[model samples]
Target: MSKKFVLIYGDAFVDYIAEDQSNSRFTKFLGGATVNVAAGVARLGAASSFITVTGENETSEFVRNELAEEGVDLSFSQIVPEKEVSGVYVHLLENNERHFERYVDVTPDIQVDFSAIKNEIIHETSVFHFCSGTLFHPIALGTTRKIVENMKKSNVLISFDANIRPLRWSSEESCRETISSFFNMVDILKLTEEELFFLTETTSIEDGIKSMQQYNIEALLITIGAEGTYAVLHGEVVHVPVEKVIPVDTTGAGDAFVAGILSKIYLEGHPSTKEDWIRYIAFSNRLGGICATKPGALSAMPRLKDLQ
Candidate 1:
């Protein structure tokens, strides 16, 4: 049977992207890390399913239409009451990186229950992608934890991304504690160098690797912006350099990278050796590099043909 890629994004935010922080004009995109991953996977000709909750508002309609057009399965998505609205995030692009300010006060109303879809969808899932953004919302955290625990019992490979947005959490200490607990369930872990420090409380990559051994993780990917990425598998780490691109907007680049790696591994099965991981990382780097050359997250995500 072909592996099905399932992405859970409880916190689906409408992104208002701006080139200059002071600009009054903003370009909107269906944002959220997991959403980008789902779209990118579909673009790569993979069966990608997205799980999210939104209302009947304009933001929700836009997101729904966009995902449908991308060929992403939204069978697990929920449409809440009209008064409830999706979260909104405003991003400012500078120095090939992104700065975010979010309006998620209304997200509590956009509730989700993973148990509702457990038997119908998640049971048949192969790769379950989980990002830490959902943890920021108390209403979503309970269901998120339940899904992770269930995924563990079902023997599904859990792919995790620490797309940490500290400002959204109650406190940095709380964020660290909660995110650390999640590491125990992760099989394939991906995070930026800074996020690695936050979760592991270590100053260097070597120390971070040592701390990660306590978890169920089989492989770890540490992305160092601009410098490249470090892929660790079976106790060995290999550095993969990124291809250069004149970035127009770096939004969704990391999410695109995750999708690229997932597409390769899902199609061929998980990497067995360091060389295999290196090759996957190189391919992912190219996808991310290409994403940087465009604008918006999903809009920037490259198709398989684009990479070829």
Candidate 2:
């Protein structure tokens, strides 16, 4: 049988990353967490389908064209004339870390309609991935919940990445509450060390994971840059380390990691044993590390050739 595609749903943003620590010069690239993942999966030779809303303008055309160039299928996406694609300015800090400085969203209210998503797409999807980017809007939140509910009824593996952006949400409490609402419905959950503390309201990693025990999440992966990833599988915690790399840009590293995990699950099937989970997490860590060594988000994503 032919392998099923990894279905991703979220916004597509034009990232304006600063050229250096001075934060003066900027370069634009096609980005957003879900956009990076969709392209990353396809770069790894896995089938990927993206679901998002674009516009009829030049920027929207660029987003669609770039995604198509990266081998991402846009068959499930929509094009609305009034919808202006969002843009975010990223500032590089010490250690090549990225800080989201400002977000320019002309049409935050526009979102994908869940009811319009065909049932056959859901049936053919081996893995469905989403993030907290669109959850700040009520309409998008409701649509995400509806989509998750439908995916739950199917055999598709559900993946959620709490790609938290404080600038996008009205308040921290609202962001935490909105993201936590989908924890129980997701099969795999990915978070950064900071996002863990923000969501669980805890200072330590152990405390954060302890607080999240109430949710029915199957696998919880907390990515710590350079060191590695901490994965909670079946009730046991395992630390999966990665080879060190001198990172040039950390933007979209987490998205690359999520794409790696979801692609493996889609192409190879879900990891059944504890050992299986560790191997998958380790592979994802390598992908994230490789992405950081480069510059742009989607451009930095490792293709099959990069892995060799």
Candidate 3:
């Protein structure tokens, strides 16, 4: 069975983000890039789903409900019993300088059966995706590798977002090795300026694109917020300038952009040309701008109507 559309294959967990306003603390809402991107795809009115190991706790249950509400089909998640639901602990962000207190490690023992989810979703999808963050973990990484290989057998276009969480890969050497392995595997690669800097080991965007081209990647998106974004495909580079907006909470902006790109390509039936890719980047940037103007990651992720 060929996949219907996009299938996000890893890291569906809670992100307990805290923001301190003056002296008061508040939760920003639960988030994770993979889930956010999956929800964003659904918001784009596309056939997209998520596959990850979820805990059978209240938090996991809540996360499942939240994802369902966001329109992400949850049939692909593997529920792990007797394990604590995972969450990211935080301190406060003063002008985006997020000072961390502690990172709560509630991650369950990842024992997912890759063939099960792949048999159901990836086998029928046009694109299969996962971020680099979770691939750093042993069990999830190993299982995801198997799934990616299986997805390849079905001719699924593998998309990878090297959403490098600073805390996850602290060392530059570790960052280079892990991220490159991820790029080497995926057909499509998308990363922000910060992510490209780390993965390519180049402060220059040109150098970054040059490095990625060596991986035989079909497409590479270099997202530069506010200023706009650029994409490289088939040895040509195209840039899309962003539409300006005052943001309320810029949480899921990047994922929103990714959804926008994928929506244009997979759903709208656009060709993967240099011009088309640039147009998709602009379309995605518009989606990201809209998401930032809203409050939460899920809440801000706009639907197809919002795009118009």
TM-score (all chains, Cα) for each model: 0.93, 0.98, 0.91
Q: Is candidate 2 or candidate 3 better by lDDT?
A: 2
lDDT of 1 by residue, 29-140 (tens): 8878888999998898888888887778776787889989999889878777553544555566456467776665554645686656657465667678878887876767
Tens-place lDDT per residue, model 2, 1-308, is 34469999999999999999999999999999999999999988899999999999999999999999999999999888999999999999987899999999999888998778887887888899999998999999998999999889875789999999999999988998889989989999999999999999999999999998898889999999998999988778899999999999999899989989988887778899998899889889999999999998888998878888
**Candidate 1, position 107, lDDT:** 46
Candidate 1 TM-score, C-alpha based:
0.93
lDDT (CA) for every model shown? 0.79, 0.92, 0.73
The top-ranked prediction according to TM-score is 2
Angstrom error at residue 255, model 2? 0.8
Instruction: In angstroms, give how far residue 249 of model 3 lies from its true place.
Output: 2.6
**Best prediction by lDDT:** 2
- Give candidate 3's root-mean-square deviation (CA, Å): 2.3
Give residue 113's error in model 2 in angstroms. 1.5
